[model samples]
Target: MKTYYDVQKFFRRFGIITYIGNREAEIELSLIELQSLKQEGVISDEDYYQCLGVLSYEKEMAIEKRSGKQ
Candidate 1:
């Protein structure tokens, strides 16, 4: 996968959907799925780390956004 969206799509192929409204929850679920895929050898370490980085950035941005809104 080239991006987080691509990684999410890859998971979707296996009926794995990590999106459930909350940004933090979604990111957590996505991370779990990414780890599972990595352990299963379905995705390379590079791809897994890349996707994790993206998700982590997104999570940080989300937290910042929410804190700013408060």
Candidate 2:
């Protein structure tokens, strides 16, 4: 999970697809799904952390981008 595309592919493996036009919202939903999978023991710690880091980075970038427009 190095990029946002990787994150989407990760979730797709679990039959999960997320996208609602907003980058921040998409990341937030992905985080929620990731947490649920973690709690259910559906994913390993390594994958979870890797995806989490990517999502966090993407979220931060989205935030910065949105703020820059204001």
Candidate 3:
């Protein structure tokens, strides 16, 4: 996916709507889910890496937001 919203949409396709009241935690879980899907061969290497990159970017942005950087 290109963004966290896209990732959320992807998870929604499987009826997964996870939220533990923590944005960072949710993104982390999404990253884990993406990794799992990659390991299971459900997605290609390119797709896996692309999604991970998006998640990582989101995580970094979240951290920065929490730190009042942007």
Q: How far is 41's C-alpha from truth in model 3 (Å)?
A: 1.1
Across 5-68, the per-residue lDDT of candidate 2 in tens digits comes to 9989989999999989988999999999999999999999999999999999999999989899
Q: Candidate 3 has what TM-score?
A: 0.83
Encode model 1's per-residue lDDT on 1-70: one tens digit a residue: 4556786787787789887988788888898888888899987788778888888877787788889963
lDDT of 2: 0.93
In candidate 1, the residue pairs with backbone N, CA or C atoms under 3 Å apart (3 or more residues apart, or in different chains) clash, namely: none
Model 3, which residues run further than 4 Å from truth? Answer: none
Among the numbered candidates, top TM-score falls to 2
* 1 against 3, candidate with superior lDDT: 3
What's model 1's overall lDDT?
0.81
Error of 1 at 21 (Å): 1.2
Supply candidate 1's per-residue lDDT for 58: 74
Number of backbone clashes in candidate 1: 0
Ranking by TM-score: 2, 3, 1
